[model samples]
Target: MFEACLDRGLTLKKVLDALKDLISEACSNVNSAGISLQSMNPSHVSLVQLNLRSDGFKIYRCDRNLAIGVNVASLYKIVRCAGNEDTVTLCVRDKADCLFLTFETESEYKVSDYVMKLMDLDVEQLCIPERDYSCVVRMPSKEFARICRHMTQIGDAVMITCVEGGVSFSASGKLGTGNIKLSQNSSVHEDEAVIVEINKPVQLIFALHYLNVFTRATPLSKTVWLSMSADIPLVVEYNIKDMGHIKYFLPPKIDEDSS
Candidate 1:
């Protein structure tokens, strides 16, 4: 048997919405430690990792390690049924064909229950290696999403240039060019602000459409971290407050003809 409780049902809803655009189905591992899922996009051009520790949940228990395959969109739909202030509980027994969800609103003295069918999937877990990135940019998640949305109108890809000044996002097309520069505001002492760190300045091009889709995660966190390096995938991370974080790694766009 396995069961987990979350204070805010909307937290799981938000996280699912962020991944719904990437993959339709995934296998979630539930154990004593917590629940986690890592899967690559259908195109295999990007990967997403989600982790929520047992301590992060209000109540978490698992009798045995179980791999539960689920239709993410369906699960997300079930979570959406929960009110913003409602508490959520998920329960599933060994060899169960469906997962049960319960949502309760204390103030209103209301309760809701949902049962979502499960799936059988041969999900492969990848081994992600560590890397020392050359550039790390921390900025408001919404700002990054806005820039990507605007750039997509002009071109299909964007070139990221990170230097001492800041990080510049630019895209060129037949009509014209669009560039948005986010410079670090060192003077601002606010903890929730933009920060740009560069060890070795680098310029790289990536698919703007993918980046735009990635912005779907902006709702999960106020601040997003972009860790980039040459010839390596770009890492986008969002911290879910008291819970753990979700990370995405997208391969860079490189010309095969070039050395």
Candidate 2:
């Protein structure tokens, strides 16, 4: 059996909402540590990973490890029915085909339980090794989202260049060219700070459409980290408050003209 309760149901709702655009169904692994899910888009152009630590929950228990498959859209719908302040609890029997959800009002007045059928999604966990990136840029989540949104309006792709003390985003299309640069800001609050660390100058181009999708998680965190390296994928990570984090991996685009 596995059960976990969250003080705020809205947090779970937002997490699911952030993943709605990328994957439809996925398998969430429940263990003693917590719950985690990882899946790639249909085109495999992008991958998203979610982690929710056990210590962050109000109540958490896991007799044994279990893989719970679920439809992302369906779960989001059920969570949406919960009030913003309602407490949500997830329940699963030892070998049940359906996952149970309980929502309780803060005043301890109303309680609701929902049952959602689980699926048998063939999701294989990939081994992602940790390595140091050549450049890592930390900036406000809203700022990154806004830049991604605007860049898509001007071009299909955006080139990100990391220099000594700053990072730049540039896009070019038939409409025109647009460039935005941000230097390390030390005066602002840590959450709103823009800090760039680079071992060596590196520049890479990426599809703006996918980047815009990644910004869906902007609401989950105030700060976003961009980790990049030459001939490697860019890691966009958003720290989810007291819980864990959600990360998106997108590979750089190859310049066909240079080929």
Candidate 3:
């Protein structure tokens, strides 16, 4: 059995919301300092790592590296019912079941047993190999969100062209093209609008949905970190805390003519 507690209630709520946006309907893995959800939405796009340390919570103690792959939708429902802004305590009881308890007054609400259709999800522990990245961009979370909202109007995919100067988020389709530029100096604090320059341009195309999922953690962070290279997977990272961070990678699209 594994259990943990937090001093602030909203931190749990934020983490749950961030996970809910990415966690798949199929399976999930929770381990020391991290939780990962793979192949929950589509085949080509999957998230492998999410660090909870930035939220000021770490593994108090783990008898073993517990891997619980459950239906994220089921977990989401249970969390929703537990109410918002309440101190949350989560425990995994064996490999078969998990528990969510909320404390208020002298009472604790057990919400997990209320979930009738408990999915028996098989857990697959994966080792994600690291790769060297050429370009990195750091910018405010709110500005990134604004760029996403604007780019959605143009197309299904956004083309991120990275260079030494900075990164540009652009989308073009039948409607037209929309672009937002972010520079390294852009403040992750208080500033809503941002623009930046780069040294050499490395252009890549990514599904807007994946970008949306990765950037969802931006609001919880002061800034977002992006690492990319020409015709390679892009890594988006947010340092939530000194010990924890969230890293999201999206595979680049291959062009037939260029190849």
* Tens digits of lDDT, candidate 2, 163-214: 9989999999999999999999968999889999888888999999899999
TM-score of 3: 0.77
Predictions in order: lDDT: 0.88, 0.93, 0.62
Candidate 3: C-alpha lDDT: 0.62
- Cα lDDT of model 3 by residue, 75-157, tens digit: 66666654454555666656546454544422454322342334576655456777666666667776676787788889888
Which residue window of length 10 is worst by lDDT in model 1?
185-194
TM-score of each: 0.95, 0.98, 0.77
What is the C-alpha RMSD, rounded to one decimal, of candidate 2?
0.8
| Poorly placed runs, candidate 1 (over 4 Å) | 189-192, 255-259
lDDT of 1 by residue, 6-47 (tens): 988889888999999998889998889888999888888899
Model 3 residue pairs with clashes: 24-40, 54-240, 54-241, 164-199, 165-197, 165-198, 165-199, 166-197, 166-198, 183-196
What global local distance difference test value does model 1 have?
A: 0.88
The better candidate by TM-score, 1 or 3, is 1
Q: Please report how far candidate 3 places residue 138 from its true position, in Å.
A: 0.8
Candidate 3: RMSD to truth: 4.0
Most accurate candidate by TM-score: 2
